[model samples]
Target: MRTVLHGRPLAARPRRQLRDHGDVHQDRLAATFADRCEPYRGYGAGAFTILRKIRQGTPWKEAAGSAFNGQGSCGNGAAMRIAPLGAYFADDPKTVTTQAIRASEVTHQHPEGVMGGLAVAHAAAVAAKARLTGTPPPDLLGSVLDHLEDSFVRKGIEKARRIQTAEEAAYVLGNGSRVTAQDTVPFTLWVAARHLGDYRAAITTCVQAGGDVDTTAAIVGGIIATPPREWRDEREPLPDWVRR
Candidate 1:
């Protein structure tokens, strides 16, 4: 949500929000994550390490790239938080892709990790556009796959396109079981594509799939639906600093 609020304005006023070379400034994003992400709670090990590096005053790029002994992280962390950025730039596919890459690189530098963010962002962008147009997309996953290059994530999505049930998708696509982008994004996208108009059903399906349920539900929820008022009231409120 913060990324969307911060980044949406950048579309109209790039000079104000972006650096001279047109890249997103990572300082604010890093600070946001540092303040909100607890070390050992629900965050993955890669995310914990990257956030620790940022808090230690390491440069954002260096901090992200240093994870996993320089191999960088290929975890689903980036994809999980990127849907809002996608929705914010829903009308601009190019910006969606570019900005999603920039945002993911702040915490996930591995190509697969970055691609995971790109895929989810692109899916959200498409979903938002469909909502605005009041027309359901005929091929949501197809559009997302079109924007991606060959990767395990892409392959999983390709398989998702063929699968018919959430159970099958979780089985064939790995259901966030490995907690990698390859294991998570495809299954979430599959759920979102199936229940684009039914938020409750979408979330229920995610939970039933059973691996990394929270992350999968978060990703799917971010793309397809907003929580009901009662649902929102049941959870801890957003930080005051978070813009609605």
Candidate 2:
């Protein structure tokens, strides 16, 4: 398990950075993530920046996701920043994937990065809806793969072929601390896949296998918070402080 590290670049983005120059349409929701999110389980730093821009009235396209620095999909910022999308669409995966990609585009411009967020958020949304509906979707992993539009995230999953445990997958897939969707998304997917239904266990396990705490937590939280069975659970709320 990757233990937590202090002063690591995997730091959560501050809410204060929600600049007025960012986006304009969904700026409110994004800003709420900035204001209320915990960086990890909440909106991440990069994510906060994009959200604030959105709230301050930036279009989702220009806030950050647009061909950033002309590199396109350069950072794990996309995956790191996309948790709330899953929560909002907790009842609908198709909606969750659609919105998450839209949200991820605020900064994570690369198709791979966008795909990473899409896969994770969609998985979480499906998990939540399944538990609520008692239908429990088909193979959790296959479902995620089916929805992802990026080929890179899919390639990373292929890289995970030899990985046995989440830890090994981390060694091969990375935890997104590197800020590249390629580096971070695959590992989160592996961990989430391993613990498809057990949300609590999933979060703790990922925390222990730490790399990017906030991003990993957010990814796993999206999954656990919305699983396929409505198991009895009681813990910290996601805080309605968001979307203010």
- Best TM-score goes to which candidate? 1
The lDDT, on a scale of 0 to 1, for candidate 2 is 0.60
- Can you tell me which runs of candidate 1 are displaced by over 4 Å? 1-23
Taking all chains together, the TM-score of candidate 1 against the true structure is 0.87
lDDT of each residue in 64-180, candidate 2, tens digit only:
653445545555655644554564567666666666765665567777777887877776666766777787666666767777664878888767655788777777788766767
Candidate 1's residue-wise lDDT over 1-244, tens digit each? 1222211222222222333345456677666566556443446667777878788888888999998899889987778777777887888889988888888888889999999989999999989999999999999999999899999999999999999988899899988878799899999999999999888899899889898877788788789856666776666544344422
Which prediction has the highest lDDT against the true structure?
A: 1
Candidate 2 residue spans exceeding 4 A from truth: 1-60, 63-68, 72-74, 80-84, 87-94, 135-138, 226-240
lDDT of each: 0.79, 0.60
Residue pairs clashing in model 1 are none
